[model samples]
Target: MHCSTPKTSASLDPALLRANFPIFGNHPDLIYFDNASTSQKPFVVLDEVCRYHTEQCANAGRAAYSWSTQLDRAIEDTRARVAKFIGANAEDLAFTSGATESLNMVALAWGLLNLQDGDEIMLCQRDHKSAVLPWYNLKDILATQGKTIHIKTFAIHEVGDYDLKSIKDQVSPRTRLLAMTHIHHVFGLDMEVAEIREIVGDRVLISLDASQSVGHIKVDVAALNVDFLSFSGHKMFATTGTGGLWVNPRVKDSLRPMKLGGKSEATPEAGGLNLKHKNTAELLEAGTQNIAGILSLGKAVDLIDSIGLDAIESHVSDLTVYLYGKLLNLPGIIFAPGMGICRCEAGFGIMSFRFEQISNLDLSFVLDEENIFVRSGDHCTYARDTSEEYIRVSMHLYNTKDEIDQLIAVLEGVVG
Candidate 1:
């Protein structure tokens, strides 16, 4: 282990930030490099969850008990925190299981309400299954209704960088909706969002799958001018069952609720009220809700803010660039073009490469034997043609320079 002294935070202290995460102290040897999949929770978030279950364990908007009231407050507080983090109004944010559920809610509900024959939904090939599958499923259903479901994709150049012109050209007057990720999960390339919005020019509604970009970087949905956005709490250091979806005020009334019943009505005028006709967020979310998970989400947001996203991003870029340089020099290692550490405009915490002589499964197994965990395969991007698979190592704030060195050491031994 390397000898180190704690640095005092002039802004948000990294050392103080480290103390807030129990996992960092408890598992000193564990190098968690798979942050793109899900981030480890900090102690503050864990305590929030523990405190909620132990003291405020009750349902919200129900019986008039003290615990229930506390639960309701906690849930609403999380909604506010999430909204502030992304620059959206709290009333526009809706809770769901995760990004997967949030996305499905939008696709199934919004697709049913607005989509018709000859309408188009454009997406990127690099989106995760959570963002891709729901809309694809809805497309199938729409086809049965005699509505044409046209799929248009924005292409990435051979170097893994996006060709913004391709997306600009793909948008037509008939395009009704566009759903895509804010960042490419496979390669960690940030999407051209503002440019895409300009090209669409209010002719179509834009939905962003912000699951990968929200916690890692700064996201302002209002400034970006997106109609819808979905992100998971687990990816941002909260519990897995918690996530939120943003529905812009413009199309709030148009959003439908695919699931309903149990604590969803504002005021039931009839015996069975209309679930799909409520106000913005309420119309989309209908359930008991994950009260504890939502509370933890607020804590996670606080933790990220205290540490500072800009500092974390800078450190991660440095680490990734260093790793890229070392890996590029190794024999039999296949390096994707335009991927070198972190460019100011392009890549971030995630980077993917492969070994020419070794299969992806074999490479991942060998790396795991050394306890250097890394992701392998297509990584759920359905649009990608599988001519070549990859091995992925995604870093986060908790990861250190030494850990990146260790990853290189193990890969060198395995490949050699």
Candidate 2:
């Protein structure tokens, strides 16, 4: 679904927003166009993380000390904050290192438990390795488990568009799960999760890898109707080594927890080895936890909300559209025809293209020499049909028109 809210008289002041990030100050000439990889943290997030480690450091949820108790509430409150940010229930959300573990958690916990002989799982060619390998691991285990499982990869249009009718054809009585990314990292294809959900219905479970979609766009879990979703914090202006997994409550009891040890949320006996895990996310979390990183993640939710998601989406889209217009006149630049210009909805602030005169790596190297950063190569999309390495220019709220102009100027010189 698209977010097309009416623009207020006072639009986002990107310069003021850019000033909030410390990295820009540290390197005066740095043009960070690699947000799809990881976002630079705002001072608010950095301060929150710093405060957690220096002033209130403690292991949460286990100790009787006052610090631990307070930290426990703080951690849980962060969970509530993220849930509210995504329009999800706090009880349905759980903490993980990042989306990778989140995807793996669902694959091992749910897929391994539920999938058996005659059951089929569908994945797309563009899915990240994190999303693909977990299912592949499950496929490998099937032989030892004495089960027959079928895995299928459906085709997308050459322009990175999903064919819902083609997808419907792939589903059958044996089809159990449809695991794909809500926004593709390479092509920036925003799969119609709502429409895909309608296609699957109650017959096939939907697992969405929303690592690219979450912070870039406004995503309501209720609207998407996904059984499981995985997204990272570093991609969202939060600290790295922190992210989340959201499980639909309808199947919470069905998916077992992957990591388990020590005390839990509701277990009464102290130091009990084998204890009952509460139905909530406490069953999923273990060990000392990334207290600092999680707190920063909570702050990121607040930061994004304060800016307003609609404004962020609108601003990023405008920048992408403007960049596409400038690049179209340049020589030998190639992506899906009309992709960045016409299908701005499909490409969420990311433009992946190739320059015929220069190799993708050389193009990236030249951009880096100018202090303009972008990711190049396959972007972890090994399953895709495209053979040539590509240049990926990803934008964010802090990206100014001047930066895009600089990028276009450099590109023109290279092509000319």
After superposition, candidate 1 runs with Cα above 4 Å error: 1-18, 266-278, 341-346, 383-386
Clashes of 2: 0
**Tens digit per residue, CA lDDT, model 1, 304-405:** 887777776666666666777678777787754336433333246778888877887888888777777788888887534544467888877777767888
Q: Give the distance in Å from residue 310's predicted Cα in candidate 2 to where it truly belongs.
A: 1.0
TM-scores for all candidates: the values are 0.90, 0.94
lDDT tens readout by residue for model 2, 68-184: 999989989999999988889998898889999999998888988898898999987566788888888998888689987888877566666566777888888889999988877
Give model 1's TM-score versus the native structure: 0.90
Scored by Cα lDDT, where does model 1 land?
A: 0.76
